[model samples]
Target: MRLTPRIVPLLLLAAALLGAAPAAPHPVEAQAPQASWSWPLEPRPAVVHPFDPPERPWLSGHRGVDLAASAGATVRAPAPGTVVFVGWVVDRPVVTIDHGDGLRSSFEPVDSPLALGVEVEKETPLGTLEPAEVGHCAPAACLHWGVRRGDEYVDPLQFVEDRRPSVLLPWAGPP
Candidate 1:
């Protein structure tokens, strides 16, 4: 093909137009807020089951996904935010990070060293998974992580891409 001056601009314009087309919205984008976040687990493990069917006759469906990890594994923050809640829920330390713009991440059965109101970077260490100690979730330790926008829960994996920084657990490996 011989490239002429006139044709070159036209080709470039066509390429630009194609590239400018809006990307398709991610599955969770509609439900998620403007802020971005991600899973704290490294290597992006697959969810055993993303959604749990409603078990009760008058109840709703499962709100979050479960990541597979060994007990005492580290759990990191999925995004940059503030530690909104860090305390023992029935003796199992739970940590909640507020990633502003209405986005938030929550992890149960955490061994968090950060206190409430602490500002954390993305992938910062949140705590470790002590399954044997935490009665609510034991045997095989894993972080029961959840993402919330306002009050509604959304899937965390869909928001952040690649290895973004976040609150980290001591045991978490590189993503």
Candidate 2:
């Protein structure tokens, strides 16, 4: 059991074999906290565009989802939060809500009457969808919804629905 010369080669071989084995895959963690958040649009508008984040921070990519909505349709808050911003970003109007815990939601092209510092509850009417020609789906108005955790943008759909990928289980023939 001591460090004898004859036992050294066997110990080295065992160490090499253990190191060569593949490591167990790490579990994927949910980026955002689970909440009972709802869709901002009633009847649940269609997702015209989906989240496609850029590989790098400064790269060009679709950072949020675009929902098909009509011009002048009422847009509501998906969860309880305080209005942190209400103004025009670039060529379209925007309303941003701070939901605490470093989570913030922003909706663009929304003609919000709500002022900054105003508290909003789930489903509260934040504003109406404003017609914009600069949106990805131009000519037809749509809502651009985005969420952020700190500085990192996250999938807004994760707030409204379970974002877990569907897994196929082993088939049991007679179940």
Candidate 3:
């Protein structure tokens, strides 16, 4: 096939992505290379809202998971990372940690005293959760935890739990 000018760029981009990604036997292996991440909140906080990544960036969707917590509830880091941003994201205080590998976790309405550029390990004390006046779990307080790979929103549950779903790691297939 004769490659057009536009097609050549597309092909080069695809090849670059494949070369950059870890060689996996299957797509799932490449998708989830490791499951070393930990939970952000201890005592396994109840999930008030689940992740619902939108089809588009402008579309409406729940980008993260909401954990049922109380005011002043302890919030911890889910992985070893550097504090990239620690301040208000909108109306509520937020703490964003960069876990390297293009992955980052964010907690909203948190009272984190840590400043940006601080290094933290898994289960490191981030701060306490500040109750929101008009929150997802209103009347009862909760914390909104989010994870992102670059600019793409990823399911936060995958970090805390093994997302293999089935008993076997790989899908059954005929020999």
Q: Pick the candidate with the highest TM-score.
A: 2
lDDT of 2: 0.90
Candidate order (lDDT): 2, 3, 1
The Cα local distance difference test for each model comes to 0.73, 0.90, 0.87
Q: Cα deviation of 16 in candidate 1 (Å)?
A: 34
lDDT of 2 by residue, 77-122 (tens): 9999999999988888999999999999999899988988999999
Error of 2 at 106 (Å): 0.5
Q: How much lDDT does candidate 3 score?
A: 0.87
Give the CA lDDT, 0 to 100, for residue 93 in model 3. Answer: 92
Model 1 local distance difference test score: 0.73
Each candidate structure's TM-score, on Cα atoms with residue i matched to residue i, is 0.62, 0.78, 0.75
Poorest 10 consecutive residues by lDDT, candidate 1? 26-35
Model 3, 1-175: lDDT tens digits are: 9989999999999999989997655534435534677777778888899999899999999999999888888999999999999988768899999999999999988999998899999999999999778668777789999999999999988877777655335655688
Better of 1 and 3 by lDDT: 3
Residue 86 lDDT, candidate 1, scale 0-100: 84
Model 1 deviation from native, Cα RMSD in Å: 13.4
